[model samples]
Target: MNAALALHGLSFNYGDRTVLRLDALTLQPAETCAVIGPSGCGKTTLLHLVAGLLRPTLGTVSVCGQRLDELSVSACDRFRGRNMGIVFQRLHLLPALSVLENLLLAQHLARVSRDGAAANALLDALGIGELARARPAQLSQGQSQRVAIARALVHRPSLLLADEPTSSLDDGNAVRAIELLRTQAQSIGAALLVVTHDRRIRGQLDREVVLGGAA
Candidate 1:
């Protein structure tokens, strides 16, 4: 089977500082994996690299068989918008857009047809349908996070990348969030790769990929 994501000789450097190094890594279709490590272990950096938000100093990142490193900057952006869904650690929702609008914007930016029905269904599935009109500022951390997840899934991306998705929630909310992510990803046939420092989410995933640790 083709890998949904693959990295070989993946190393990232920040000027004189080398932050991440990985010989090989792969995540298969419909498979869920958690990337766990200590602070500054380059877990988030790895997510950025895979998402095409950052270019690796060495090695290549391939998503859905396309070599991200080989694409032009504009081409990479278009590919990422169409094929990848990223739940940023900061939950980068536009403050001006309401819950529903934020999701709609994702569709618009992806250049896909705007599907209000699908967006509404996703918000309803995530249990945030009632808050569709609420702005991001009005949401609590958990609510905002859920909205972010819904936004990520609106485009039905082949690969979902989430960074520190449950770091702020309590145990209960964190578990719920993880389950929601898994269920939603499976439903959409998207491979899930979540990079988090939260050990609480380790056992909740199908497998764990530890960075900056013994092999």
Candidate 2:
């Protein structure tokens, strides 16, 4: 089978300054790994590259056997929605929409058929079924974080990318959040790549990739 994610000689630049570079990286389906590094080491940049949000200045990125560099802008967006899910550091839930609507919106944007049953099932699995009708502004920090995670996984993406997923949680909630991500990703058979600085989570993953310098 094709690797869930692969990068070769990948490098990204911000104008003349190089921000991130990786000679090679690969993650198999259903595998989990953490990308850890100091500030400005391109941790988040790597996630964006894999998610097709930014193009690499050099080399190639392939997700589920398809080359991201080869896809057009529209194709890339569609591909990302169907194959990848991202939990950004800032949870970008639409405050005006209810929790269930946010997940449905994700499906709508991905061009997938809207399935409210699947959406509600996912919410129930995350232990936030009752909160499905609540708006984002009404949820607590932990509740909001769970909603963001459910939104990412509602589509059953093949590759799951999470940035600083546990950054703001306490010890208890941090562990719970990581477990949720792992369980949900495994259920969907997606390779999981988490970009985080939290030392508390390093031991929980299958392996850890430590990045050094900004190219």
Candidate 3:
């Protein structure tokens, strides 16, 4: 299988404290891998490193076979914006912007043009078509989450990273959201990495990787 992201002997520390120490991992294309563990087990650290938000102190981190160590920070940021779609816990939508505008803004940041038809179609699919004009402040938690999903997916990235994406959702919505993420990843031929402490999503993943586990 083709790898979308790979990490080799990844170890990171914040001053004297070591946060993550993974030997190796390679996520296959279209693979929906879940990183499941305790709060400080470094699930977020791993995702941040993969997303190029953090640098590894040891070994190499690669995305789409390009070694992160080789890429400059600015280049990494550009690569991340273009190739990775991230659904952060906070959603990070601009409160002043409407739903359509938020997605368009994200697309612009990725240096890609907005696909209005596709964006609207995705919102419609998420059952939020009528919310196109609604700002983030006007939407409920569920609606906001779907909009975040839409924003991440607007550019059809090769990797989709989620940090406990469905934590705020109810059981049904959580399952549906996970399914939607995986389904969209499959449709775009992207690898999906969902980091979560929620055990409910454990059984729904294609493969489960526990942080700090011996392999």
Query: Which pairs of residues collide in model 3?
Result: none
**Residues 62-94, model 2: lDDT tens digits:** 999999989999999989989999998899999
Query: TM-scores, in order shown?
Result: 0.94, 0.95, 0.94
How accurate locally, in lDDT, is each candidate?
Answer: 0.91, 0.91, 0.89
Give the clash count for model 3: 0
Candidate 1 ranges with C-alpha deviation above 4 Å: none
Off by over 4 Å in 3: 212-215
Candidate 3 Cα deviation (angstroms), residue 85: 0.6
Give Cα distance to truth, residue 132, candidate 2, Å. Answer: 1.1
Residue-level lDDT tens digits of model 1 in 4-116: 99999999999989999989988888899998998899998899999998999999999999999889999999999999998887898999888889999999998899999
Q: Model 2, which residues run further than 4 Å from truth? A: 213-215
List the candidate numbers ranked by TM-score, top first: 2, 1, 3
lDDT of 3 by residue, 83-165 (tens): 99999998899998999999988889999987888889888987899999998999988889889988998898989999999
